[model samples]
Target: MIERRLKALANGPELRAHLLDPHTEAHLEAYAGNIEYGLGTVKMPVGVAGPLRVRGLFAGGDYPLPLATTEAALVASYHRGALAINDAGGCTSVLIDEAVSRAPGFAFPSVRDSGEFVAWVLGQLETMKAVTGQTTRHGELKGMKVTIEGNHVYLILQFHTGDASGQNMVTLAAEAICQFILENSPVTPDYHFVEANLSGDKKASAQSFTSVRGRKVTTEVVLSRQIVEQRLQTTPERMTDYWRFSAMGGVLSGTMGVHGHYANGLAALYIATGQDAACVAESAVGTTRLELTPDGGLYATLTLPNLMLGTVGGGTGLPSQQACLNMMGLAGTGKVRALAEVAGGLILAGELSIIAALSAGHFARAHRKLGRERGQEDTDTSTGQGDQP
Candidate 1:
């Protein structure tokens, strides 16, 4: 199979040998339904950053975080920022909101029918919630959003999912809710579907940005001027100025986030801990702020509105992924909120370091140094072809 793939790519013997190397002892069955023409597991470089501290509603104390990424200087930059945060007595993290939602739309023959359906749905809210409750013990119907068009109506069901990312959970709950609506609602629709495209599940849309999709979490830190100058090698004032400029740039560009490198930390963490890494689509959108304090300190905050994470289910049960989750004490129930806080803390560290490097004029220099090092690591001929017994 690998030989065929290599031939398809028009590659050489050496490349074929390299491709088969990582598969030698891997359990291909583990990925039974996950891949096609599977040869092996692709490896990612996971770096541990910080014995960083967090004071939060759920997460507290000091711990080392595992960040898996291929980007050069990502781990180092976040580490530097974490150290600075540690020096300033650590940071505080909090989970502010939680919900997982799906919108199912119904199109009727006329606007009056849509209105009747909407009115009926509103009246059956409690019954709808009860029907959804039968789907899962961990998921509870939280709320519903209603949208009306010319002859279409959308009912967005929201659920509070415990210890899971909730895409599947909410889908199940929505199914049960839909069944109830179908059986109970008086205004029958001309047509209906499970997803109305109003939920904004995975894509960039105004509804997701305006409301909660998964969990809305906020993490903040206060960097003392001494820590900033000593650890980040930049003045608090300069960092603040740069942050202001960056915020303006985001505004001018009309971007969803007003932050620096939230993806860097979140992506690495998500991959390491077996999260649905694609959820970073909505999870990565939020606000970051740099507030200047009178004592020359910097108050930094990163708020993630749709951080989809879980300590169980999905890829979390995979051995290596579970190990990574366990490393952060995130391998059991009641850890989802704490994990969100940790994610927020890491984002703060990453942003602080990148902002510092930008202010100190070392961004390019560090990349040049670390990136060349990465290139050399990739070239180390330590790989060998696999043999099936």
Candidate 2:
């Protein structure tokens, strides 16, 4: 059995027991699109952070966030940050921009043929938009960007997917559009492919970061100086100083974003919400900034450039995932922006916690206390450039 194979490879008896049983096939069927072979599931512990209040364009009020992760102190740290934000009236989140993107490629026998196709493509832009629009009820083809290299052309299609993530929607829409091109265009391409690798889907690339891939959410919070000192155990001035140094480190290290531990919260949040967990690769790339207020308080901002998420599709129909989504009032259409807002809120909470820990010089001590078991030595208690870079 696969369980036996896993046990042999992992060299452990624990896998033996866990793999022996899993959510029944009937239960798994809903979540798994294609169950080529049945293998058991790995379970991770889920933790709750917040009753962290949110003031967002879509999601408003207080709600506890469900973060599914096994990292020892992750939940605790975010929880502490949420407490601090809540103590300061809550985070103000906004889904600043929203779009779903896909890139399709075409190849021709020669440069002249490709140029003819490009001309034909430009001519058919209106018809192309009309044809793809027929594919989905909620989705609309927003725009198209063209790029060419030698005898090939790639079309980057952008869509407003409503409440669904729209990967499938875009794929189906692309197929319809491609078929139209193959049949209706005057110049026939020698070969064609659905994706040209330029779309930057499910990966961290400069294009996806700068342009919209999923949802671009930006959240801001103002913390009172008293709250900063009492809850975070640091002053606003010191935290801002650390942020400036960390920003430089991020730039020197060639990081896409200067945020602290964005992936930590995003991955956990994605899993809990039944979001396409792989989307976190592009979704978590963004910038974080802290400005010391004139009154000695702090103003913190988290801007996520590509937060690809959907509330009505993909793994969301699964019962357990549905339940988790329900907890945050996000289980149907027209709620994705709300879900995105909450995600931005959580990101804010997470980044705040990490910087505060660094400023107080308790960065290593708290990890030592919460991250270990039994009497294991707390060896990794260093607050240095190593932690940031």
Candidate 3:
């Protein structure tokens, strides 16, 4: 029916043939509620890294890291780091906190009116909760914060979205809450909007570093001196030296968080496991620290304050994505937190490998070897020699 309608439009037949092939048309019904205009699917190459062992509060096991990306050496880098962590009995990961926010803006004529509105809204928390409950069974209105700027008020409603990324869930709940507010409040604002762009949704912001967005997780691993020297091809002292210098560079350059390539591993994993890939903007914002242990080993840690993802909703139910989740034994109910832990572990591995490569002066060499075509010449003159330490 949808295809027939498209076929009636100009150049529709050509577009449909390219996008909606016979195979896609056969399973078109399965894509309902997931896509609009429903063309087809884009296939991305997926690579598996690990049997990565993770010891966490919610996740405990060796799981394969399925990464979908076209960039070569990404999977290999993460794979090497995962093996190093496993040699040291894996990383320790913890899901520290979880919450999604929806910040609605209200514009009043005067500061007095805004203050009055905020006070009244605070008093109506119970009523707001009731309205939110009607919107989603899996979402709960955890709390609200009122930020007043001049005559404007931003109501940041925080929610605990069970087993899902909860962007849509929180938005629906917030919309319902706003409707109830508009109807019941004695003080009406001059105007209002459903979202004020203050929640840091799909954007990187300093706010997410201080507060939770989706899921806050911390993962840490201690690699012995021998292991670092053997697996990473660098000594613990050299890695720490490079880390300290790199951290200083980040601060001088005013980067949001000091880390090496959190997006590389995370974006790949998110794509493979049916997560909201765009959330990587905020989800990838965090800190990675490497220091020398008292015993002369290396202590590495990664803390992601906005690790927004789910194991049951959005793309997770898709056939390919579900298969990837199943490969890791993390799909469906009671596994979201565990899935988050695995993400933390995966990210930590990438950080370890990338930092090691840079410190050992093998970054460009590895990239040229794995990322370049066989006959591609290294003609760039930015760095004098192809091999430099």
Give the TM-scores of the predictions, in the order they appear: 0.89, 0.89, 0.92
TM for candidate 3 is: 0.92
- Candidate order by lDDT, decreasing, is 3, 2, 1
Clashes of each: 0, 0, 0
Q: Among all windows of ten consecutive residues in candidate 2, which has the lowest summed lDDT?
A: 380-389
TM-score of candidate 2 on Cα atoms, chains taken together: 0.89
Off-target runs (Cα >4 Å) in candidate 2 are 1-17, 20-26, 32-34, 374-389
Supply the global lDDT for candidate 2: 0.82
TM-score computed on alpha carbons, candidate 1 = 0.89
- lDDT per residue (tens digit) for residues 327-383 in model 2: 877889889999888889999998998999999988787776767554743223332
The true-versus-predicted C-alpha distance at residue 165 of model 2, in Å, is 1.5
RMSD of each: 6.3, 4.7, 4.6
lDDT of 1 by residue, 1-389 (tens): 64566677755466656655645336555555545876545678888888679898999988678889998777777787788888888889898888988998888999998888887788888887788878899989988878888998888888899998878888888877777777877988777888887877776555655788877888888888888777787898999899999999999998887988787788899999988889887777888899889898989988888888898888787666888988888787999988888888888888898898898887877777667655533211111000100
**Please, what are the lDDT tens digits per residue for candidate 3 over residues 199-275?**
99999899977799999999999999988887888899998898899899989998889999999988999999989
